[model samples]
Target: MKWVLPSLLFSLFFFFLNCTDVDYNEKSVNRTSRKILIDASHDGGVWWSPQSGTYSASLPHQGKLMADFLRSYGFTVDELPSFSVITDSILQQYDKVIRAGCFGTYQPSELQAYVNYTNRPTSLFLIGEYLNPAQIDQLAENLGIHFQGIYYGNLDTYAPHIITDSATSFYYNAGSIIVNAGTNPAIIPLGWLDGDNNKPSLGILQHPFSKILFIGDINGIESLPQPLTLKIFKWLFG
Candidate 1:
């Protein structure tokens, strides 16, 4: 709640940047060119913090990294506002919608809009600390996805982890999932809250969509190296 001012400011700034000169029609009509929208707007809290303070909401690195990665991937990558503004018209233009970083406190209308987007046959890559209970439930209600609560201080205890489950194929050496470059049906488990915290795991989902690969807790904004990010961009839209 206290981070409202900077978060709103950042969101407004993002909305204007995309709305002002972005020829959505032109971008959408490029049938051969795949498009992906990276929601790098960081208005959420950190691992230990419950709310991202006003001063900490300006996470421009997320936009910078994702845009570069998608571009390299040969996809027409556009950084969208929060999922709240993602309407049918907007959804038609992009192939994948990546919720990068924290999905913090957004307006009710925006949340409703995002829920509708999830209902359709679309792809969403939710990274980092996901969101709170209400937003998580909204995704499940619309897209049939749900997150398990994270154990408190699990990250500290289980340092450098990796996922070896057959259902969830990952490539990283540490964390719950690995970062393989294959087209496998995987859900990269990212964040988790304590039983008492009970928000949602970053990688759990009810819908078993193909290509649902999650690279657990790797803050594409804070962690991914710039070069690897470029590779990801090239793979998406470049």
Candidate 2:
């Protein structure tokens, strides 16, 4: 009877160790398995070269740097080609969607698809710089935000948010003005240009199951943006 009890205790000790190891492994895998989709299709001024009779990609250097930066954090980053469209199936494959420096216009169907996608449990990061004013307005309207076509510069003001610290100051070559169009409780302003507290230069909208982060300019991808960009990515991946 004494030998039997010791044998049972030995078995239980090994079993507990095995269970703890499995849980640790599972947590580690989950932490590194996060997926991010960087939509490069609309960026980089993609066009066909008639002389070469082939398509070419003029992807922004900053966008490429952003992808590399994300990969360094152990996140699986997918840079979709310009020919790719944001579809329901495509959106499902990623936990976060980043639309950066997109100048191309979206079709009505594609816009509707984005609307549907944003209404779901997803995270969208919208970065625009010198994009089509009409397209920007369209997107703002769809998101229930007001976007003025005018570009603001010399912005020395910032609202404190997850992506910025109290000492952080930001300036953009050019940026659009965005503000909440209605009294939607879900929309929250993140930052604003100096002397212009009424309009938001950066904002986040939280839906029931989804969230959207809007940046008026692509300066966040620049080297000077520094900790702001890093903090933004952390917030997104978190």
Candidate 3:
């Protein structure tokens, strides 16, 4: 297997970015272990993109890493195969739901199920392209959260192994994020097209959000040493 970028660096990037001198209630942030659900189901069990390759490979490699990492961070993690099967009753039991950026469309009922889940006060980590913009907007509005970026057709930033385009960068960048408008603005601004030539490329919006963490790029989580990922699991879950 070819490791395009060391997963250790990627993990660290997220950890440090979230560890600045922000006045988060250390006690509150470190409360009891939160239940975290990893959503990996896609419509038709595949992701569709104009780019190329099989849909099975479109899922984020970081999902497993993130789950294990979060587990180390004092949180309980579970890989959910089908979002449709995860009913509202099951969702309400968890504290956090990390959306692994599914690239396919959802059945009307499935979308509605997500609606019910977001209505309550549950922390959500959305990674990847926001499929079905309409449903996304509805959920965002309900949650009083807003994420910038207009989707232009389909830009697949994964195949070429370059962060210069959405088509490739999105393989890693396609995950959902925490968009805090009042406190942390959109830092590490990402788009399918670079402004000058409009060519595809990965860009970071440099605004900090929630506490001191940057939304666009998670430096610490992405760059942590392999051992550290386990350390993070312990921190978040222990």
* Candidate number with the higher TM-score (1 or 2): 2
For this target, which candidate reaches the highest TM-score against the unseen true structure?
Answer: 2
Which of the two, 2 or 3, has more TM-score? Answer: 2
Per-residue alpha-carbon lDDT of candidate 1 for residues 1-238, written as tens digits (9 for 90 to 100): 8899999999999999888663322332234547677664442432213323332222443345545644554566666443235455765565577665444444565556666565656566655443333544233323334432222233211112232211221222122222221222333333332321232233434343322323334342344443333333233223
Candidates in order have lDDT scores of: 0.42, 0.63, 0.41
lDDT score at residue 104, model 2, on the 0-100 scale = 57
Candidate closer to the true structure by lDDT (higher is better), 1 or 2: 2
User: What TM-score does each of the candidates earn?
Assistant: 0.44, 0.72, 0.43
Off by over 4 Å in 1: 1-33, 45-60, 81-84, 106-112, 128-222, 225-238
Q: Model 2, stretches more than 4 Å misplaced?
A: 1-33, 44-60, 131-135, 152-155, 181-184
By lDDT rank, best first, the candidates go 2, 1, 3
Error of 1 at 40 (Å): 3.4
